[model samples]
Target: MDTIIIEGGSTRLKGQVTIEGAKNAVLPLLAATILPQEGKTLLRNVPILSDVFTMNNVVKGLNIALEFNQEKKEILVDATGDILDEAPYEYVSQMRASIVVLGPILARQGHAKVSMPGGCSIGSRPIDLHLKGLELMGAKISQVGGDITATAKKLKGANIYMDFPSVGATQNLMMAATLADGVTVIENAAREPEIVDLAVLLNKMGADVKGAGTETLIITGVERLHGAEHDVVQDRIEAGTFMIAAAMTSGDVLIKDAIWEHNRPLLAKLTEMGVEATEEADGIRIKSDLTKLKPVTVKTLPHPGFPTDMQAQFTALMAVVNGESTMIETVFENRFQHLEEMRRMGLHSEILRDTAIIHGGQDLQGAPVMSTDLRASAALILTGMVAKGQTKVTKLNHLDRGYYQFHEKLKALGAKIERVSEVEHV
Candidate 1:
């Protein structure tokens, strides 16, 4: 088992971090490869992560020839032939984001059979919303033996409404609607920045999409799409993680290439907690004074509200604050799994359904812990940074799925953290 070892008690993260392209954005962009039939879609600033590799394999299985230039952080995908509509269990089982490919696959091939995706055990993320939206766009959807098959003979656009603003559902339906016959209006759509990024690329690829970053999206079908070059968006979650960590440690750190507009909710909360965040040249600089911190109540919601992705990291930040803090997670059910792991590092909290009440302002003792998911892995590491003695976090496969060189980046900021493949028993 791979474990991250960190020496804690008195460490501060001080430096600038250059974030990579968003994993959330790049996955849907890769799925967009099925829209173009000629020339290669060139994607720049793609994050070199395990999930990216899994998605590439999934697309390759469907006959897309992909060449990954990791050195330049770019990928060239030729999805000229959307020949195979079957996404096997081997590839899709490795990443949940592989489900996004189903929309493009069905739009191009008129049929798609993909295995039910598997990834982090954060929650029971049902693909029902994705299927319902696709069905509205004229896809015949059925499931048998964990394999979902969607078939459509010339998809026709229609008015669709989402019960919830799911990011995955938005991306999938947006891609499917690009090749639809008439105007497809998606009401109550996701307003995440990643959604807007996908819309930007789809439009560049000849899709008539509008109203991104809003609750409503209108998409008109195009005859055929041509390959276009696009740069992936910066990861707002990664930048938020650093912002919380810098404030928790009372350190001065600048997160480079971070968009302040994308993280207004998090920045505002940090400000209420007495953290200083200033928008500088092309980045946000965060600084906190080494004093008692104010506790703030938070509730995770859709975009323009506090993001659910940042909730885990925020919980860890609240563990050492000056007062009690309450966090209500409205997005996923099982996200508080990391709070149990934090108990090993002396994080005091009471969990009641979707809400967690954290008791802060206490010295924590280090102990061995386990990572439950991608963001939870980051939260554990951040919690270990403030605990006394040495902390060891295992089950890092979840961490590698999203973050790229995470420990290396933290080390650059002067945190005593390292990842090792072996463990020495005492």
Candidate 2:
């Protein structure tokens, strides 16, 4: 097992860090590779994360030829040949994002059998929406043993309404609608920047997908899609994580090539906490000189609102801010697990159902902590950077799924952190 040890306390992080492509966007883009019937699809600016690797394996396991050039941060996918209809449990079981391939497989082969997916233990993210949307498009859905299969002779476009703006469902349904018959409309769709990124790639591949980054999506079916090259969008989540680090430590850091419009909510919240965020020509710069941050209330919502992914990191900031802060997680019910872990490190908070009231300005001491989820791992590491003495964060596998070179990036920015194995640390 690997552990990240952080020597926290009054460390001023000052430097510029470049972020990688969006993990959320790239996974669906990788899955979308199956939609093209001929030629090669080139995805640039791909992040080399563990989840990306898992999704790649899932794509390759479907008999699709793919070559990943990590040196160039690009992936060339040739999905023209015979594609497998079944995505075995071996690969799909490793990551929940693997479920996205189900749509493309069904679109190409008129059938797809994928095993139940697994991922971070933050909450129960059901695939019912994906199945329901596909069923609306004429797919016969059935579960056999541990696999969920969707079969259709020819998928016809239909109007589908999502109860919640789930990103995964929007991506899955949007991709499946590419080769579908007639026009498919998605109501109450996810308006995330990643969704817009996928729509851009699909449009480049000859699919008529409109109204991305909005509440509705219209995908007009095409006879077939050919290969195209697309650059993945910047990871707003990773960028927001770094921004929080700079704010909490009262540091001045520049995140290169970060889009300001995509991170408005996080920046707005940071401004509420008295942190200064400037949108520069090259990227977004975060500079904070406040000894004590102003506590603020945060509620997680869909796009154009506060994101649920940044909730954990914001909670860590709320723990040591000036006054009492409130964090309400309306996205995942079990997301407060990190707050319990924070209590082990001198955090005082009260969890009332989905809401957590944090008593800020408490002195935190470093201790051994376990990561609860992907974002939680980064949150714990961020908290350790502001804590007293040494803090060891275990279960780094979760950290590997999202952020790339997190400790190295922080170390470059003057953070006292190192990743070491258990044997090496001893």
Candidate 3:
């Protein structure tokens, strides 16, 4: 087991951090590469996180040959020949994004056998929306044992309106609809920048997709899609995490390679809380004054809204604020699992239904805490930064799945943190 130990420094952190590519965006975009017929698809600015490696393994399991340059951080996915259509349970159980292969496989091969995916214990992220949308698009889907088998001799596009604009479902259906016959329209689609990023790649691959970054998406079926090179969009989650970290430590940090437009909601909230934020052409700069920290209300929503992934990190920021703040998590039921661990770190938080009421102003004294999920691990580390005593965060593997070089980046920001293999017996 890996653990992160943080010694309270009391010093304000000040530095610059380069935001990595969006993990949520990159995974699905990688899965979409399965649709390309010829030429090696080059993806640059990819984040080297555990989840990315897991997705890469899943892609490899499908027998799609890939050449990755670790130093350059580029992956060349060559999906030329007859690719494997089955995504075994072994790979899918590791990450939910593995289910994304269902659409691309069905689109290109006319059949797919994929395992139901499993990911963070945050909540029940059902794939019904994905299956239902594919069913609407003329795919015959069935469950055999623990796997989902979908077959579409020839997919004909139709209207797919989701009850909620699920990002996973939107990406799946968009890829599946690419090779579909006729026109496919997705109503109430996710407006996340990742969706647009995938659309941009698909268009470059010869698919006609329009109305991205909006509620409605229209895709015209193309017979074949050729491979194209594309650079992934910068991760807004990474940028938001750095922003919250800076705020928690009352630091000044510049996040380069971040898209300011993609982080409007978080930026707005951070600005409201008295965090000095400036948007530049390249990225955004965030500086926090400990004296001005204040409580604020945040409700998690879908794309173009407050992301659920950032909830835990923001909660840590609110822990040291001057007043009470409310965080409503509308995306996942178990997202507040971090609050229990936060309490162990001297945070005053109460969970009522989906809302967490945080009574701030307490000088957090760090204690041993366990990470429950990816974002939760980040929140714990952020809490450790401002806490008064030594903090040990166990189960750091979850943190590795998302953030690249967690402690290294914090160390560069002058944080007193270290990743040690030795575990302290409580």
Q: What C-alpha lDDT do the candidate models reach, one value each?
A: 0.91, 0.94, 0.90
**What overall lDDT, based on C-alpha atoms, would model 3 receive against the true structure?**
0.90
- The numbered model that scores best in TM-score is 2
Runs with alpha carbons beyond 4 Å of true place in candidate 3: 423-426
User: Per-residue CA lDDT of candidate 2, range 183-225, in tens?
Assistant: 9999999999999999999999999999999999999999999
Instruction: Give stretches of model 1 more than 4 Å off.
Output: 423-426
Model 3 earns a TM-score of 0.98
Q: Give me the overall lDDT of model 2.
A: 0.94
Candidate 2 ranges with C-alpha deviation above 4 Å: none
Pairs clashing in candidate 2? none
State the displacement of the C-alpha of residue 244, model 2, in Å, after optimal TM-score superposition: 0.3
TM-score of 2: 0.99
What TM-score should be assigned to candidate 1?
0.98
